[model samples]
Target chain A: MIEFIQALRDPDIAFLRYAMAAGLLAGIAFGIIGSFVVVKRISYLAGSIAHCVLGGIGAALYLQQVYGLTWADPILGALFAALSAALIIGVVSMYAREREDTVISALWVLGMAAGILLIAKTPGYTDPMSYLFGNILMISSADVWIILILDTVIIVISMLFYNRLQAVCFDEEFARLRGLNTRMLYLLLLGLTALTIVLLIRIVGIIMVVALLSLPAAIAGQFCGRLWQMMIAAAVISMLCIAAGLCLSYSLDLPGGATIVMVTGCIYLAGFSVKALRR
Target chain B: MMPQPVISFNNVCFAYDQTEILHNVSFNLFEHESVCIVGPNGGGKTTLIKLILGLHHPASGSIRVLGGMPHANSRRIGYMPQSTHFDPSFPISVLNIVLMGRLGRRPGSFYSRSDKAAALQALAQTGLVDLAARPFASLSGGQRQRVLIARALACEPELLLLDEPTAHVDPAMEQQVNDTLARLAHRLTVITVTHELGFVSRMVDRVLCVNRTVKLHPTSEITGEIIQEIYGSDLKMVRHDHQCSQQGHTHD
Candidate 1:
C-alpha cells in the first residue's frame, strides 16, 4: 500500500493526472450514453459488447504469438472485432426478423471465447487479463487523448442531434414520418455505443462496463424528469462511483474496475431499495 | 370546386403481409369537418389513422394531407395515439409529453418561451394544468388521457388525428375528452379512429366503419342498423379495462 501511494507520489508517473482526466471524460460519455441505454433498455447490449472485447484481444495476441505479428496493441484487434460485430448486428436488425437480439447475444459469447483462445495460443505477452477487466493505472497518454477526443465528439454529436435523438428514442415511427431519416440515426447511435464500450474498456473493464452504463441511469431515473436531466444525473453518479472506487482501491489494494463496478452496484441497490420502500 | 380537401385518399390499400388491412380505401376529409373511423378489433381502424398521420404508408395507393403527401406535411398534422397504448412507466412529466407535440414544428430548434406558454395553455385548456408538473407514470387513467389530449392540442394543429382518444379514461372523463374534441373540430380538421360509437355519433361530422374494406357514412346517416352490420358484437354496455387499456398507449 505504501509502495502504491509512493508510486503515485513519483513525478516519473506525472501522467497520472492525464489518466484521471481521461477516466472522467470517459465517465461522462458512458453516463450520457448510459442514460438512453436505460430508457431504451439496452444495458444487455453494453454487456455483450464488453464481453466481446475478449475476442478482439485474444485474436491480436494469438496472431502475434504464432506468426510473430506485433502484439503491442491487442486492443486494436479487439476493437476491430467488436466494431465488426456491432456493424453486423446493426445491419441484421434492419433486414432480419427479431433476430438482432439473438445475434448480439451470440457475439457476446463468441467474442469472449475468441479472445481467451487467442491468449492461450499466444506466447506470454503481458497478461491480457488486464484488458478483459482494464488497467486504468497503465493508460497511455495516447489512450487518454483518444478517450478525450471520442468523448468530446460523442458529446458534440449528441448536442448537435439532441432533438433527433430525442425524437428517435421516444417515438421512432413518429420521428421517421417527420423526415428525420431514422435508419441513418439508428446506425449512428449503434456505432457510438460500440465506441463507448471501447473507450470504457480501460477504466471500467469489459466485464464491468455494463454496471457503469446502467447503475447511474437507473438511479437517476428516480430524480430526472427529462432526458437531459437524466444524462446529467448519470454523469454525476458515475463520477462519484469512479472517485469512490479509486479511493477504495487505493486503501484496499484491490482490482480497480471490479471495485468501481461493485461501488456502482451498491449505489444501484440502495437507490432501488429506497425507491421500492417509497412505493 | 372540391373545396380543397385537407386530406385526400385515392384508392389507398394497406396490408399486413398477406392479409389486407385496408383494401381500396378512398376518402376526402375537408378542413371544416371532424371525422371518425369506427370498427371492430383487428379491423384496420388504427391502420387508417396511421395512413393519415404518415406513420405508415399505404400498400398500393396514394395519400395526401393538406394537398401534399403525408410525409411532406407531417408538420401540419398533430396525432394523439390511443390512450390504451401510452406507457405508464415512461419517465416524463405531463408538461414534457405535451411539449412533444411541438417536436415536428421545426427541426433542431430549441423550445422557445412561446412554446412553453403554448404547452401550458393547452394543458389548461384540457383541464390538465394541475397535473402538468406530475410525472406521467403516476397519473390516473383519465388524467393521462387528458395530458395526451393536451399534447395533441399543444401543436396548434390545422389537422388532428387521434386513435381511440377516450379508450382508457373513465366514462366521466371520456365525456370530457369528447367535449374537447368537439371544441377542436371548429378549428382543426379532426380525424379520429375510435370505438366510442356513443360519443362519436354526436361529435363527429362523418364516420368510417372499417374492416378489410371501409364504409364511410355521413354522421346523419348512421343508425342502429349500421352498428349491427359492422361490429358483429355489441358495445351497448361494454368498456375497456382502464388498467389494461393504459398498458401501451404511448407505444402507438
Candidate 2:
C-alpha cells in the first residue's frame, strides 16, 4: 500500500490519472444522453450515428492535407461531417418515412466508405490505432477541458428540457396534438445527439461511442422506474465502468476503451441474469 | 342547456397521397354533447379525428376549433388515442402518463406542484387514483383505457376526443366507462369513435355515420334501417336479428 501510494507520485501516473478523469467525465455524459436514446427506441439509430463518425475523422484528414489545416484542427472537420450526416438523416426521415431505416443504413455505409477511401489516399498516416478504438493516454489537458465543458452543457440542457424530451419520446403525435412544437424538438434532439457524439470522439472512439452511451443506461434500467433515477443510476454505473476499466487497463496493459466496453458487456450480462432469476 | 359548437368543419376534405378519403364534408360539434362518430372500418373515421386534432391537414377544406384553426389552436382540445399499440415495456407510471395532459398550459415546461395536484385530480376522476403509483405496463386492458382517459382529462380542456375507448374492454367495464362519459357530457364537448353500437346507444346525444358520405342522426332518430343504409345490406339482417332480441325497440 505504501509503495502504491509512492508510485502515484510519478509523472506518468499523473498523466494516466488525468486520462482516467477524462474517460470518467465522458462516460457520465454518455450515460445521461443514453437514457433518452433507449427510451426513444432509437438504439440502432445511435449505433448508426456513432459509426457514422468515421466520415468526420476522414474529412478531418482531407482538410489537413488540402486546406493545410493542422491535424489538431480536425475537431471542426469532425463537427461539420457529423452535422451533415445528421442533416441527411433528418431530411430523409421527414419526407420519406417508409425509407427512413434504409436511408440511415446507406448513410452509415457511405460514411465508412468515404472514411476508408479518404484515409487510404492520405499521406503519412501514423494515428491509425488511436482512431480505430481510442488512446486515452493521447488526450491532452486541453482535450480534457473541452470534454468537461461539453459534458456540463449536455447535462444542463438535458436537465432543463427534460419534460419536452419526455413528451416527444412518449408520443410525438400526441405532443403535437397538445400544441407542442414536436418538429422543432425533434430537430433539437438530433442536433444534440450529433454534437455529443462529435465532442466525445477523443475519450471514447467514435466507433465505440454508442456502446459507452447505451450500455450504462441499459444496465441502470433494471434498478429504477422513473426517468430521473435512471439517468442518475446510469451515470453512477458509467463512473464504475470507467474507473474499473481504467484500472484494469493499467494493470493488464490493454486498450482502455475496449477494456471499458468489455466491463460494460459483463455488467450487462449480470443484469440479464438477475432479470432472469427474478422472472 | 345544449352548448354552442366548439368544433366546426367547413367543406372539409382529406386524402392520403393521391387517394382522397373525405370530400367536402361539413359538421359542427356543439359543446355539452356526447357525440360518437360510428362507421365501418376504412371509411376514414380515424382520419377525420386526426384532421380535427390537427395530426393531419385537410387536403382542401377548413377545420376550426374554438374560434381558431384546428391545428393552430390545438391547445384547447384534449385527446385520448386508441390504446392499441402502446409499448408495455415503457418505464413510466400511471401518474406520469396522466401528467402529460398539463403540457398545453405550460407548454415545454417542467412539472410544477400544481401540475401534480391537477394530475392527481384527473386520475381520481377516472377512478385511477389508486393506480397512480402502479406501473403502466401492468394495468389490465380496461384499467389501461381508463388511465388513458385520465391522461386526456388531466389537460382539463373544453373539448375531449376519445378514439375507440371501449374497445378490448369487457362489457361490464364498458358500461362503467359509458357511465363516466355520461357524467362528463355536461362539462365539455365529448367525441368518441366506437364500434360498440349497443353500449354507446344510451349515452350518445348525436351520432355521425360515415360510409363514403357522412350522415348525421340524432340519438332518437337512430334505427336499424339507417344503420343498414350506412353499413350495407348485410348488416341490416344482423341488426334486425339483434334489435328483435331487445326489450325496448320494436322489430321491423
Candidate 3:
C-alpha cells in the first residue's frame, strides 16, 4: 500500500492518473446505463454486445496488420461493431419478438468465434489476451479523452431524456399510447448501452464488462426507491469498487480488470445478503 | 350540431398470423360515453382495445380517435394496461409512476409545476396522494392497480382506456376502482375491458359484447340472454346487488 501511494505521487508513473481518471468516468457511465439495462431486463443483450466487441477488435487488428491500414484503430472498430450489433438486436427484438432470444444467442457465439478466427489469421504474433482481460495500465491519454467525450455525451443525453426513458422502460405500451415514439427511445437506449459497454471495456475488458455494468446497479436497486436515486447510488458504488480494486490489484500484482469485477461481484453478493436478511 | 365521436371504428378488421381476431368491427364512442367491453378469453376484446390505442393497425377499413387517426390523437388518449404486465419488484415511487402519465404533456425534459400538481391531483383521485413517496413495489396489489390508474389519469385525457382493471383485485378494492371510474366517466369517455360482469357500474353507458364480431348494446338494454349469446356459453350474470348481499351474509 505504501509503495502504491508513493507510486501515485511519482511523476514517472503518470499512467496511474490516466487509469484512475478513466475508471471514474467509466464507472459513472456504467452505473447510469446499467440501471436501465437491469431494470429493462436487457443484460443478456448487453452481454451479447460486449462479446461482439471482440469481433471488431480482431477485425481491426487483422486489417491493420495485413493491409497496413494505419487509421484502423481497434477501439474505433469496436465502437462500430458494438453500434451495429445494438441496432441489429434492437430491430430484431422490436419486429421479431418471438425469435429474439434465439437470435441473440446465435449472434453472441458467432461474434466470439469470428473474433478468434480473425485473430488467428493475423500475421504477426498478436496477443489478444490484453483485449479479452483488460489491462488498465495499457489505457493511453487518447483513450482517456475518448472515455471523457463518451461520458459527456451519455450524461447529456440521459439528462435530456430521463423522463421519456423512464416511461419507456417502465411500460412501453403505455409510452406508445402517450405518443412518445417508444421504438425510437428503445433504439436510443440500446445505442447508449453500446457506448457504455465500450467505456467499460477499458476498465474490465469484454469478458467481465457486463458484471461492472450490471452489479452496481443491481445493488443500488435493492435500496433505492427511484430510478435517479438508483443511478446515483450505483455510480458511487462503482467508483468505490473501482478505486478499491485498483489499489488491491496494484498491491498484490493482480490483473486489474478481473480484480475489479471480483470486487464488484463480492459487493453485490453482500448487498443481496443484507437485503435478504432485512426481508 | 352533435359532437364528434371521441372514437370511431368503421369496418375495421385485424388478424394475427392468419388467424382473424376482429372481423369488420364497427363502433363509435361519443363524448363522455362509458363503455364496458366484455367477452370470453381470446375473443377479440384486447384486439379492439389495442386497435383503439394504435398499438396495432387495422388490416382494412379505418379507425379514428378524437377526429383523427388513433396515432395522431394518442396524446389525448390515456391507457392503462393490466397490472400483471408490470414487474412488481421494479424500483420506482408511486409519484414517479404517476408522473409518467405526463410524458406526452410535458414539452420540456423536466416536469413543470403544473405537471406535478396534475400528478398529485390524479393520485388524490385514486386515494393514493398520501402514498406518493412510497415505493411502488411495496404497495399492495390493489394499491398498485390504483397507482396505474392514477398514472392514466395524469394524462388529463379526453378518452381513457383500461384493460382488466379489476382482474386480480379483491371485491372491496374492485368496488373502489369502479367508483373512481364512475366519477371519471362524467368527464371523459371511458372504455374498459373486464370479465366480472357483476363489477360493471351503473355509470357504463353502453356494453359492447365482442366475439369475432362486436355487438353493441345500450347499458339499459343489456340482458342475461344477450350476455349468454355474446359469450356463447350459459354463463349467468351476477348483479352487483347480489354480490353485496353475499358479502353481507359472509360478514354476518
Candidate 4:
C-alpha cells in the first residue's frame, strides 16, 4: 500500500496517476446511473449493454489494425456500441412485437461472440484478456480526460432531470398521467445508463462492469433514505473501492478489475449478512 | 346550455389485439360527481380508466376529459393506480413520492414552492403529514396506499381517478381511505374503480357497472341481487361477516 502511494507520485510512472484519476472520475457516473439501474431493477439491461461494448472494441481494433483507420479509438467505438445497444434494447422493450427477454439474451451472447471472433482475426499478438478483463494501469492521460468529460455530462443531466427520472422510475403509469412524456423519459434514462456503462467499461472491463455499476448503489440503498443520498453515498463508495482495490492489487500483484469487483462483492455480502443477522 | 360533462365517453370500444375488452361503452360523468366503477376481474374496469386518462385510445369512439381531448386535458386529472410497480428497496421519501403528482411542469424545471406546498397539503389531507420524511418503502400497505392517494391529490386535479384504492387495506385503514375520498368528493369529480360492494353505498352517488358494456345505476338501485345477477357469480363481494343482503336491501 505504501509502495502504491509512492508510485502515484513517481514521475516515471505517470500511468498510476492517470489510472487513479480515471477510476475516481468514472466512479461519479457509475454512482449516479447505477442507483437508477438498481432502483429501476434494470441491471439485467445494463449487463447486456456492457457485454455489447466488447463487440465495438473488437470492431475498432480490427479496423484500426487491419484497415489502418487512425480515428478508430476503442473508446469511441465503445460509446457507439453502448448507445446503439441501449437504443435497440430500449425500442425492443417498449415498442417491438418480439419477446423482450429473447432479444436481450440474443444481444448479450452475440456481442461477446462477435467480439471474440473479431479479436481473433485482428492480425498480430492482440491479447483479448486485457480488454475482456480491464487493466486500469494501462489507461493513459487521454483516457482520463475522456472519463472526466463523460462524468461531467452525466452528473449535470442526472441532477437537472432528477425529479422526472425519479417519477418515471417509481411509477411510470402515474408519471404518464401527469403528462410527463414517460416513454421519452424512459428512453433518455436508458441512454444515460448506456453512457455510464461506457465509462464503467474502462475501470472494470465488460465482464464485471455491471457489478461495479450496481453493487455500490445497492449498498448505499441500505444506508440512505433517499435517491440522491444513495447516489452520493454510492459515488463515494465507488471511489473508495477503486482506491482500495488499486492499492491492494498493486501491492499483492493481482488483477486490478477483479480485485475491485471482489472488494465490492465482499462489502455487499457483509452488509447483507449483518442485516440478516440483526433480523 | 347544460354544463359540459367532466368526462364524456361516446360509444367507446377498446380491444387488445383481437380480444374485445370493452365494447361500445358509453358514459357521461358530470362535475363534482362521485362514482364507483365496479365489475368482475376481467370486466374492463381499468381499461375504462385508461381511456379516460388517454393512456389507451379507443378502437371506435371518442373520449373527452374536462371538455377537451383526454390527452390534452390530462393535467387536470389525478390518478392512483391499483398498484405502483417499483422495487420495495427503492430510496424515496413519502414527500418525494407525493411530489410526483406535480409532474406536468416542464421536464428540466425544479419543483416550485407551490408544488411543495401542494404536496404537503395533500399529505395532510391523507393524514400522512407526520410521515412525510419517512421512506416510502418503510410504510405499511395502508400507509403506502394513502401516500399514493396523497400523491394523486397533490396534482390539485379537477378530476381524480383511483383504481382499487381499498383492495389490500385493512378495515381500519379502509375506513380512513373512505373518509379521505368522501371529503375530496365534495370539491372534485372523483371516480374510483373498486370491487368492494360496501364502498359503493358508502362512498359514491352512483355505481358504473362495467361488463363488456357499461351501465350506470344510482346508488339506491344497487343491491346484492343486482350485483350477483350482473357479475354472474364471478365477482366476490367482501361482506364483512354478514350474510349477503343482511343490510336490509332485499334480493329482488
Candidate with maximal DockQ: 4
lDDT by residue for model 1 (A156-237), tens:
8888877677667766665665456777877677777778888878877778788888888888987777778888888888
Instruction: Tell me the whole-model lDDT of each prediction, alpha carbons only.
Output: 0.77, 0.77, 0.87, 0.87
Chain A fold similarity by TM-score, each prediction: 0.89, 0.92, 0.97, 0.97
* DockQ score for candidate 4: 0.76
lDDT of 3 at A270: 90
Model 4 per-residue lDDT tens digits across residues B95-192: 99999998886544699898899999999999999999999879887898999989988988888999999898888888888888889988989999
Candidate 4, residue B200: Cα displacement in angstroms equals 0.8
Candidate 3: list runs displaced more than 4 Å: B1-3, B232-252
For B1-252, candidate 2 gives per-residue lDDT tens digits of: 756568888888887888888887888877687888998899989988888877788878787888787787677777888887576666778898888888757544588899999999998888889999888778888898988888888888888999999998887687668777778877888999987676446667778887656777776677778777777768734331122112244335
RMSD of 1: 5.8
Compute the lDDT for candidate 1.
0.77
lDDT of 3 at A167: 86
Off by over 4 Å in 2: A1-10, B1-4, B106-108, B232-251
Runs of candidate 4 with Cα error greater than 4 angstroms are B234-252
Worst 10 residues of 1 chain A by lDDT: A14-23
Per-prediction TM-score: 0.86, 0.90, 0.93, 0.95
Worst lDDT run of 10 residues, candidate 2 chain B, spans B238-247
- 3 or 4, which is superior by DockQ? 4
